[model samples]
Target: MTKPRGRGRPKGGTDSRSRILAAAIEEFGERGYEGATIRSIAARAGVDSALVHHYFGTKADLFADAADVPLRPDVVVPIILSGPRDEVGERIVRYVLESFERDDVRRRGVMLLRTAVGGKVGSPLIIGFLTRELLPRVARRLDVPDAELRAELVASQIAGMLMIRYVLGVKPIADAPIDELVARVGPTIQRYLFD
Candidate 1:
């Protein structure tokens, strides 16, 4: 007679990480960000919760990996938070524009944006990462009354600019050089954050 299976997941096969990632995408897609949990993901992957943690430190990191996000908000936020406070707007704008200069980054960014627009499974993951992970850090840094709202407003402007310039292919704004765009938009971002 065959032995009964063990209590926990089968000893983490070589494809365990891949299985976990596949499970993560499914879980995140179905439950969105807030609803999904490490336990659930681990369960779905047929692995121990600790194994999930071992492979990916946090839910945010897992989401980033599953979604193939080019940059993690945790990483980007620090860069934005660095440098002089007064020119934060310019810094943020410049950083985003500069990143797009890389052909690979731009291609991936466009694909992700289009996917987000198409109401794909990863939309909530993207939204959750931005609103929950990214905006919160920015809000905390502002440390002002209505800081969350201010951060959201800043995101709105940037999102609109990106959609128009990159996704919609709107001329003028789209055709405009990065430096000009920063010079024009930076002050507005500054006003939203500080003024």
Candidate 2:
């Protein structure tokens, strides 16, 4: 792991990696993943672009860490699999809703969809994260052979809702609470698991 140098800037040089990550999140969130670039992240960090590469192997690595996700496949896979089989929709919804409510991920999640709409630069990283982390975890718990496709479909609905409701300020859907949101969307998700 390159680990993103942050040892000498905070507390008189104690946590530069975290500082860079925070900055990256803001840049990516504001500019869209494709619009956000290594040079830009480095420019925002007030550090060398090489430093960014040193800490994060590639833009994909930086995006994953900056998104404040659990990072490792081992770490994230368990969280997805740890939830109840039947209530997966509720669990996934709550998890994402809570993440969107966070200062760290709120904008990134929103930006993810906005960028995903048309841009072509950073889609691979986000897609890779879903296939590698999210889908695999869901697949392991699901007995169905098309578990991967199901997981992706489930995520698409959830992600679209969040983008429309929270990011795009789409009415009605945005105002819907957790239970209502799940009620409206859960059955479709549930069917994916068993049907």
Candidate 3:
């Protein structure tokens, strides 16, 4: 006779996590971040809702994994916001450049950005998550009336630069040294943040 399974995820279900992630990607692509739920993902994966939590902890965590994004907004936002106000822009630029220095991170970052910029199946979901997760935190930190707008402008600048330099492999930008890029682009980011 076989033993009955427990109430949560199936015991010894090694493929369960990957199945959930695949389901999550599909659910998020169809429903977007705000709309997708753990229960839905679990259902799609043919597992109990508790199994989703057991494997991924939270919806956001699952989203990050499903999206294959290396950087987490919750982690990155704090780092970018913690430094000196005047040097915030430089810090942001440096952070992006440094993060991309890793081949694995660059591959995932480029894929995520490309999806968002190209308006692919999950573009709005990715962009919305990033903007929603990032912009409010930045807006709360800024004293300006147009804090949200400024934050968006900064995001656009960084996104455009990344696309040109990394995705498109444009000359000068792609070839430029990290420090030089930081020196030149940092002020622009600063201006957007505080000016």
| Per-prediction tally of clashes | 0, 6, 0
What would the per-residue lDDT of candidate 2 be over residues 100-160, giving only the tens digit for each residue? 7776567666656655553675576577778777778878877788888888888788878
Every candidate's lDDT: 0.78, 0.72, 0.78
Q: Report residue 4 deviation for candidate 3 (angstroms).
A: 38
Candidates sorted on lDDT, descending: 3, 1, 2
TM-scores, one per candidate: 0.64, 0.67, 0.66
Candidate 3 lDDT over residue span 1-195, tens digit each: 986645565553667887787777666655556667898888888888988898898887776677766557777788788878889999999999998888666755665665565545457656677578888888887788899999999989988898888788999999899999999999999998887
What candidate 3 gets wrong by more than 4 Å, as runs, is: 1-66
Backbone clashes counted, model 3: 0
- Which whole-number lDDT from 0 to 100 does residue 130 have in model 2? 85
The better-scoring model by lDDT among 2 and 3 is: 3
Full candidate order by TM-score, most accurate first: 2, 3, 1
lDDT of 1 by residue, 62-152 (tens): 8778778567777788778777888999988988888877855665565456546555445775588678898899887776788988888
Worst 10 residues of 3 by lDDT: 3-12
* Model 2 vs truth, CA RMSD: 5.9
